[model samples]
Target: MTRARLKLNTKQIRARQRAGAVRGLHKAVNHLHERSTAVAPIEETTLINSAVASVDEGALRAAVSYDTVYAVRQHEELTWRHDPGRQAKYLEGPLVEESAMMLELIRAQIRRSLR
Candidate 1:
């Protein structure tokens, strides 16, 4: 393939990979929901718990911690010449912390229900 075509192909592949990763995460989330609700086989509950436990804590934190609504004012303050590195560090870190806490709450609820 030509150089330009190769770059285009790479971009397409990256996009597809991103979409597939998102779909997998969604499926995992849905599986947890189903298992918690007892909509699936009992054996699947173990699988769902395992899957949720296996999610990388760092990645989960990174995904949810960057809430625009909560951080809008902070973002605006630094916008004249924003540092992407600093922004990522500031905005993403706390979001990740909140996500971790929420995940723990969900896990606790699941545990309580199983009792």
Candidate 2:
């Protein structure tokens, strides 16, 4: 009979877990940005192209935004007319509709990173 024991460092394990989580968060944010862009109102493609995803590592938070002068107005104005398949609240709609999938994306990335 043979017996073997292996010792693992808890600190290293924790760091690895945190890194995995952060990677997941980044992926999640990018996922949101992508989905939002797909449904975003496209006027000369300015708003769609201006989309950006930002993650704050220390705060463990992320945001997807469109950097345009009229971005807010375009997102909020329900009365304004857009193309047949487009309308106001483009980002908000996607954020709500894709919430579940986004979370899954984060979880999957975390698992992958851990491995």
Candidate 3:
């Protein structure tokens, strides 16, 4: 083969091999992830119980929790200098009003639970 033709063929082979290697790597990663994260449906009950334990608390408890949230939001804005989802507008505006509405709903639930 001429030198130019040989170089072209080598470049084409290298590209094909790189593409195949990437596909193989993706398949291996997906297979391991699927195998490791699977569990029986009943295991979901314990998963939910753990999640509830993480959040079960009264309104005063929730209001105090806001401090951590505020700090995280501040850090994200100043340090990151960009919103991850540009979601700050939602949170700073309508979400605040919606949250107050939700708090009223939560207080009603707490009162009913106490009775």
Give per-residue CA lDDT, model 1, range 21-102, as digits (tens).
Answer: 5445444444443333232112323422332213443363212222233344543354444323333233334334445554
Among these predicted structures, which one has the highest TM-score? Answer: 2
lDDT of 2 by residue, 6-114 (tens): 9988887777777877888888888899888887788799899899999988877899999999999999999998887787998999899989988887788667766
lDDT of each: 0.38, 0.86, 0.34
lDDT of model 1, residue 77: 53
lDDT tens digits, residues 1-115, model 3? 6565433566766555544444443333333323222221122233212211112122122211112324334323533343233232322333343455544544454444333
Q: How far is candidate 1 from the true structure (C-alpha RMSD, Å)?
A: 19.2
**Best-to-worst ranking by lDDT:** 2, 1, 3
Better of 2 and 3 by TM-score: 2
Range of the 10 consecutive residues with the lowest summed lDDT in candidate 2: 106-115
Ordered by TM-score, highest first, the candidates read: 2, 3, 1
Q: Count the backbone clashes (under 3 Å) in each candidate.
A: 2, 0, 0
